[model samples]
Target: MSQQDARIDAYIRKSASFAQPVLEHMRALVHKACPEVEETIKWGMPYFTYKGQLFCCFAAFKAHCSFIFWKGALMDDPDNIFQQRGENGMGQLGKITSLKDLPSDRTFIKYLKAAATLSTSDLPPATKKAAPVKKALEVPDWLLSAIKKNKKAWATFDAFSYSNKKEYVDWIVSAKTDATRDSRLADALTWMAEGKIRNWKYVK
Candidate 1:
């Protein structure tokens, strides 16, 4: 048996006239495709869940509607129906203004079954790649000594966050000549003593 939500019914009724039939048809198609599929509202949109996990979601905007698979990036799309990544639409199929924009009922159900299979599988859904770790910044001994010579500069530099400290260190280290390094170091100590970060000039 399929579970449906009254809130979704009201939602469809409240949608723009052009989107009502499109939403209704898709809603029926989802239930027809997966008899065990359960419906609810998530993020103010109609959400379908299967086997205790998110199956998919759909929303009707002012001018168009969208249908998204929860694990769309992991699904196989041999039919080439999915929108290319980084496109404008929030849904895999892009902005669906009418029924003609959708794949045939058979193809749509096939992918719906594929999504249901993924929900039933033991493997976890795909996650974004982990951000790369930033390497530790090493302060040059001469720069350290120069900062230490001024108690206020040392205090300010010591209080700076890792990112703030890294900015100053990176700027000084990237200097091409010994003279430029010394000049920047002097200016850096002066700014630190005044409790200013590197690139303070750009700050509003």
Candidate 2:
């Protein structure tokens, strides 16, 4: 088993009763169908990967869990086991609370195998391309001056990721007035100098 599998197994071992068996069963089915599937943790959830792409993931929550087939939109589900709750690039069958809520092991295994085959054999549709990251708002004159005045903050902000930079800029630009913007900028510069993202301290 891969390190990710071990970690997932550990998670299941400590999870609430309703989640344990569900995740364990899904884990078994995934490995059985795709013997070469590698495991990894993504966004703090267990994910299985094959052919350089993620195949599927199972996540546990307070009341239910979700089985997400990454390329599920491409598969033909004759039994309608793949639930279509929203948009279609991925498919989810959630609110799974017990073993009986799942499709038969054999059927679920087939879905996993088919999903893996589709991911390996075909190019994803245009809608599946990763979305471009949004740009930050233009830096205001005052905010620019603050950064220039603080050498350490200027250096830190320059090295921030596009998303991080956008967060700081948006926070300041969203202020209702120049006075509010100026007040926020002072605190923003102090946080940036410490290499923190906007709202970093408040983020969970």
Candidate 3:
């Protein structure tokens, strides 16, 4: 193993455990496959690096461990091993509780090696581009009047971030009819008067 791999092993051995053996075994398998792979902690989880780029990571949760391929959405998984996570390019091979739950040693090693090769070739995974930041719009006179009439609404709207402010304004402005806009304005004002965002009650 490289110095980085040794350091990662030491770190894991010293850390608290939920699925210690599973993580360690997976780490060992990764190192065995790509001896040049460097290890580091990212987002408070163990991540592997090769050619100065992220290759993979593993995290242990309450009941399962996830092996995350940074570019999992791009890899060819003929065995259907990878599980896509929503619209994101990220994926995981889930429910990894122990060595037994993993692919065979050889298959696992092959995948790791393939990942390293792909990294070295500088082929990045296809991922959804982040949406551009939306700017906040000026508060309409009608909306402003509603806020002014409700002191609590004015204060709540003033406290909102630009994005949150824009969300409320956009919702009202997007209404097709004057009646619809007026109705939405009333509801929005009521919520704001309660010191809440558009969907504050539903937010976690």
For lDDT, the strongest prediction is 1
Q: Which wins on TM-score, candidate 2 or candidate 3? A: 3
Stretches off by above 4 angstroms in model 1 are: 85-89, 130-204
TM-score of each: 0.66, 0.57, 0.58
C-alpha positional error of residue 160 in candidate 2 after TM-score superposition, expressed in Å: 40
Shift of residue 82 alpha carbon in model 1, Å = 0.2
The RMSD of every model to the true structure, in order and in angstroms, is 8.0, 12.3, 7.9
1-204 per-residue lDDT for model 3 (tens digits): 866655556656765475788888888898899888888987777888987888888876667777877776667776666666422312367677667888888888888887777766666666777997867568878777777888888898888888778888899989999999989899999888887788787899
Better of 2 and 3 by lDDT: 2
Question: Whole-model lDDT, candidate 3?
Answer: 0.77
Encode model 2's per-residue lDDT on 132-183: one tens digit a residue: 8767557778777878899989999989888788888888889999899888
Ranking by TM-score: 1, 3, 2
Q: Which candidate is the best by TM-score?
A: 1
- What is the Cα-based TM-score of model 1? 0.66
Worst 10 residues of 1 by lDDT: 83-92
Give the total clashing residue pairs for model 2. Answer: 0
Could you tell me which 10 consecutive residues in candidate 2 have the lowest summed lDDT? 85-94
